[model samples]
Target: MLYGAQYYRPPFPGRACWRRDLAHMKELGFNCVKHWAVWNWIEREPGCFDFSELDELVALSREYGLQVVINTVPEGAPYWTYEGNEEDLYRTADGQRVAYGGPANLPSGGWPGLCMDKPEFAALVAAFIEETARHFADEPAVIAIDVWNEPHLEPMYDYRSNMLCYCRHSRAAFRAWLKGKYPSLDALNRAWYRTYSSWEQVEPPPRFGTWADMLDWRRFWLDNLAGWLKLRAGAARRGAPGKVVQTHVAYSGILGNRIVGGLGNELGDEFLLAREVDWFGLSSFPKWLMGPDHAYRHLIHNEMVAEAAHGKLFYQVELQGGAGKPGLLGGEVPDAGDVKIWNWNTISAGGKGTVYWQYAPEPAGVESPGFGLTGFAGEDTPRSLAASECAGRLNLPELDAAVRVPAENAVYASRSSDLLTFASERREEMYAGSLSGVFRAAYERGIPVRFLHEDYIGELAEATVRFLYLPLPLVLSERETEHLVRFVERGGTLVSEACPGLYRPDGLLDQEGTALGRLFGLGHREIQGLPDWGMVTACCEDGTVFAGKWYRQLVNPGQDVRVLARFEDGEAAVTERLLGKGRAVWIGTYPSYYHEHGFELDGGGKRDGTRDLLTRFMSLGGYGIIEKVEVPECESSGISLAPVVRLHRLEGEYLLTVVNHLEREARVKVWFREEQAFAGGPGKCLELTVPARDGTCARWSSSRR
Candidate 1:
């Protein structure tokens, strides 16, 4: 495990003091450090390359026994590069220059928002990468090369600049992409309903206007980013022949705009960006995730990142360490306990390497009082002590050999649904909102979820995934619809939301035939999007009433379907269709979304007992479908009480970890049913508890007794 921190800028306070900082890192049990190879800082002049500072830092790092991972900060293009290449800068649909620091920083020293569409920018980035890679290629101390910090035309997640890249390059590239997809302009017109005189006139729309153009545009950027990632990663591989190359995204595209900074799903939410890298990486802010607005999204995203990394885990490149800008929940700096829990939670949830944001906050930068393991003045803070303790704990052999926790339930997440959500006025609110709700419901119930992309729905036969939670599926291809049918036919129980597969992948209505309707036994009637709080009131078969938002699609059920819930108008809102060896329960509206959104202490964020639906699924021969550790009374004690538990199997023992998500203390009991080879976990059933905002781990084997 690499206990690491980011330190790219020259050196805080002075040249010689940085060595002392490295020594402090070594004393704290940190074995690695990631240094950003900032383009602007290095190349003061466009083509004039300088490596004096970086070379010294690398050499100094080796002296301190710290392995180095160099991040090529090409995204932060120097002011000089943009001065000569203004055409490379990203422009809005209205042809306005995009310039702003993320949400908090503002126009003060904001980024020029350079797009990869320009060859000049790409050339400069490639040169920087090649030089950096070659410089540290043979240095045994250089562990890996980061391709680029966060690759995208739109600024970081919270920029909210809405300043999309619609410059001449982007527009021409879009036309070229369309030309490749659709052979003739006439064919394009037939598909897009636009009588363009020529392909040249078919410019990219200012904003997402129609589903066709929108989906296509989103796909183009994804492909474009993927292509750029491939270039960057390949360059790094060439520079350092055998070293690991990586790049990361700020937020999981699934979380969308629920938080302040999440760049919407359409831009760069792709997990499978470039496959050449050894491991995938993503950022995680502990305090940012510990809230109603983002907690569930954070949970779901970990699973998503793990799955994206070839069904493995990822490196937490930027773990939050100190008091944040708004002071991380009322200016409260994270204590030793909070630091310990967050790091432990991350590792337990399949984070390979844990690196804090920085070694020390910058003395002169926009992000002053920044998140750092040590204080800006190099004075050791409580976070440093916590990091030291956590690092010591991770060095244990038990944690090193632990296997990843198994995901029993698969959350069937659809990108097409995300695209559909992107086209709504409520896109920001609805982005991954429904999916997060389902995941949250399952999470609170102690069920681990794997975010299986809709693209891979048909390939889940290798694993014993019992429950497939399909929330808010709007568009599906003919193949994807078949895949869902087959999964259900193979005995996987499915829980789906309001509208499932109403349109094809191309955003075209499946007018020819009703593939999804026939499979699920649901006949679409009409949809009501909005009319104030004219929210649909639903009554479950168990006499439970719940309120939900989103367009309510009235569905007439087939004979094989059973109405499990209905709307206030007595229309069948939720239904269950039994097909072959499998059963699918379709809830009319997004009750889980409402449950997550309208959380209250008395309501327990339970959303009218939506978890009862999960219980019902478990009751109908669903409980034993997958192997899981039985947590007795967790359902009764509730999410607040039931510490978030994860188990990782090892050579001879089970490494079990539990986390308390709430502020107050909570207790729980775990009883691992014995398998023939493993025997019952902990030798026997044991009861234990953790403090508020903390976590605990236990290692057990059959021979332990």
Candidate 2:
């Protein structure tokens, strides 16, 4: 594992003490360091390049026995490049050119870099990337090159109205992409519900009335970003030849605006971006960006990135180093305990490496005196000490050999649903909430859950996946719908929430001929908007009454389908049916969303007897369908051992990780099914005691007595 912190970002903690910092990194048990080669700071004049500072840093890093990953910052474009290239400036929907200014992270001005869609500006970016890669191509200390920093529409431009690239070049690119998607111009009009004389008349929608047009526009941008990544990777490889090329998004595009805090943010599609790079990664700052105490939220964030990596090596590229902000408004500086939990969370999620944001805080700029593992005077902090200890633990040979154990249980993630939610509602709160809610419930139950993307839904029948949870699937493509049907017929259990496949992938209503109606063996009726309390109660055959949230959808089950649960009004709320050799359950409302939004706790701060409708169903009669990895409940915490209990295996050896999410210690016994093989063979229970806000890592071999 490459364990280290981002040591430098030019003009901060400058060349004055480069040796001191590099030596300190080695002493802290770090084997790697990352540096940003900001464009504005490097290539100040057109066609003029300077590698003096970078070359010195690389030499010093080699002396300290630390590997370096150089991050190229094209978004920090030089002012000279933008002066005469004013036509290439990023334009908002209103056609206003985004003014050049310094962002918090980039102290040297030239913020909101030139649009890469423009061929002229793109050539310049390619030149900068190739030059940087070539500069360190022969440097042994420079192990990798990060082509793009936080691949998104426009870096650090969070203004909603000013979303990106409404320029002529972007329009041309969109037109070309449309031509490739549709066979003819009339086909485009049919899909987008428009009439156009020629393809030249086509342009991305300036406003969002038509869902189809908006969905196509968003899809084009996602594909465009992926194309940009490919350009940068190609440029880097051309220069460096053999160096590992990588890039990380700010966070998973899967979570959308929940973590990014923007409305209708058009970010890079992680799954597509991952395919263009050698290693995919994400920048995580839970304490500063996300809530300080939501450990479960942090774990889910990392898991989403890992899922998007699609079996490629993933890293925590920018782990939160210290406090969040620059000055007085800074959030909590993570303590040693926070460090331990966060690092373990990354490891358990199968992260190949982790690099903190920086070795020292920003010395100057809007982000001064923040986000450093060390103090202003370069003194080590508790978080740094904890990081060193974690690094030491990861160096163990057992962890090196252990690989992440794939889960049979999965929560479905749909980009079509995400775009639909954004286009219609202008936010991703409901869709994101529903998906995270079900994932959290399974996570709390000690059930290993992975996210199944729409692109890979067809592979489900051949995969080890047994229990599939689909939440708030408002839209589905024909291909996805067919795969879901086939997956159920092949003996995979599927649990889907309300409004499944209400709209086609193009956002056209499929009310009369809905594929989901056939899949669930039901007919859709009018939806009921509960005005009072806004909750729906469903009672199952075993008298288990659970709450359904976000209103109720009325449905009539087919003759072959059985009504598993009914609302208080005696209307069917949940239906189940056997398809081929498997079972499918359909809930009429968003129980997962309600579970996440309105969870109740007892007097002891533990969850009460109340359980979400999905969890209740899982525990009652659904457990048989799921591939079980059982861990006994915690007596003290009154919950599972932790929100995260993952198993990693290497041949006959196993590594079990139990992360304690409680405030107090937790003790739990974990075991696999009788048919599942593990350390000491199958059905062997391992007892673990984990400290509060910490975790335990145990390794066992079948050969051991």
Candidate 3:
């Protein structure tokens, strides 16, 4: 993985400027560059080809020793490529065009989204990719290719746009696919609540009948998009053998917004980790709307990227250009050092590389404000300079091995659960919006968390980690349940939330005996629903106080287990017991979410306290202990705070990290456990060491026999 910036030169494109930009990128210690090649520009003029600018840009990048991640511009084939076929475009329910019309009457609006179900459309896309790949294959600087920009739901007035494809071609293909699944239109109609007389009478459902119906449609849409990617990947590989093929997914799902579409767990995981692409990429501009806790967004992006890649290297392909008014939606601009902080945060959270959206600002373009590391004038601003310096320091080879700390536990999230939550009508209020609080809490506490898909249970079982945390509402498939049982039986500490065994694979309620139900010492006798905001005040058996929101488990603990915390209503919020050679801790409530909100609501909204508890829990579980750490102050305003820590490894060595989040800086005193003795080493007993400011590094040797 390499750190770099996005390079764009549209209105003002010259060889000299391209050379200068490449030189500037090199000076800034950028080893990679993300460049875009728009489709309209390529297919606009028949015989008058202009490779002068691109050729110069590629040559300059190679000369400067920078790798190139090229983004194909046909972003939804150009209007001319679609040949004015309305059926070749996304449509609304009423069959209206979902694209904007250009002055030339081309379907030039709304990101040029192509009708993937159209054979002609796919042929044009394949041709475009082949042409682009053939042209750039010989360029030594080109290391990877992004076949398309962000592809998802587009807002066009056409009713066809309301759902996904309903064009003639799409309807035909969809019917065929449905036939493969159900064998008959009558069966399909029964499942989808339709009364179609024949295959030709079938049309896309304008409105979904049930949650299951909507979920199935969502699955179909994902398959459609995945097929497009497959087509593009096949073309790119055939044309440019051995080159890395990748795609970028905007972090809307990470930000608690499902409106942008693209982040479905199963769809995204399978497509991204496919053998067709050597690498996968995710685009993020956290501070845009997330405010200072942009660190949380950075962490989530890394986790999701890591999960999507399934342990392969993933890139942060699009970091924010600068602090500006949020375009399209309202968002925040990071303070002076926020960009550097965010860049580091991304790396610390598992990003192998960082790439800014643009290297220099565009004078006149559709996304001008969103362009550039520097303004339109190309001055080396403070942020740009800081970013360059950070990149330089990060490129140090020793830092690579030194910075990575292997996690001791895996956190598994099911794609089925993620998609179920996303496609649910109540997704906005219930699931999607609430995940950030949990993820943000874990990050703020410096927990080395990795997102794992349910399918990777075998990998989780093989890990040397002492414990695994499975957060609540885990609707399990039989395979997942069996994997969990085996993992627990293998001496791995398993922690999960309540209501673990509920749903079957066919979306049916499974109330009979479940695989792990007895392991959890609970059964589905009652269901509890609470307000969006409520409290679960629990008193631990050890007399510690903890409070949280959402649901809790009413459990009948086995004789071998001990209840940790329970609500006043007698429901268990946290419980622990021995399973196999190890222990299992079940947290009934979503503790991470509660911690994020910090049990208070000021004008700025809720704060989080989940990190503190997680830190303490992991520490108690003998994972790793925090020796001396600075504790951040809780602010009256709604801004998030950072928590810094100096952790002592079991071998008596120390690992120190400064997590300077937004708003407040934390300072604390170091304390050692009775059994733990400090090993004398460089910076081990330093009175004051600033990891964030001076790039302080610490190492300790074990004194244990």
Model 2 residue runs over 4 Å out of place are 256-264, 326-329, 599-612, 616-641, 675-683, 702-705
lDDT of 3 by residue, 214-315 (tens): 566556666666777888888888879878888766653423322222343323434333434667667766666455555555656655665666545666
Q: Rank the candidates by TM-score, best first.
A: 2, 1, 3
Using all chains and alpha carbons, the TM-scores for the candidates as numbered come to: 0.90, 0.94, 0.83
Task: Write down the lDDT of every candidate, Cα atoms only.
Answer: 0.67, 0.78, 0.58
Q: Which run of 10 residues does model 3 get worst, by summed lDDT?
A: 101-110
Which structure is stronger by TM-score: 2 or 3? 2
Error of 3 at 284 (Å): 1.7
Ten-residue stretch with the least lDDT total in model 2: 601-610
Q: Report the CA-based lDDT of candidate 2 relative to the real structure.
A: 0.78
User: Residues 490-527, candidate 2, lDDT per residue (tens digit)?
Assistant: 88788888778989888988886466576888888877
What are the runs in model 1 whose C-alpha is more than 4 Å off? 11-13, 99-110, 154-161, 257-266, 274-276, 288-297, 327-332, 511-515, 599-606, 618-642, 673-688, 701-705
Which lDDT tens digits does candidate 1 get at residues 82-175?
5656666677666766653332322123254367787767777788898789888999999889886755554534334453668788788888
Candidate 1 TM-score, C-alpha based: 0.90
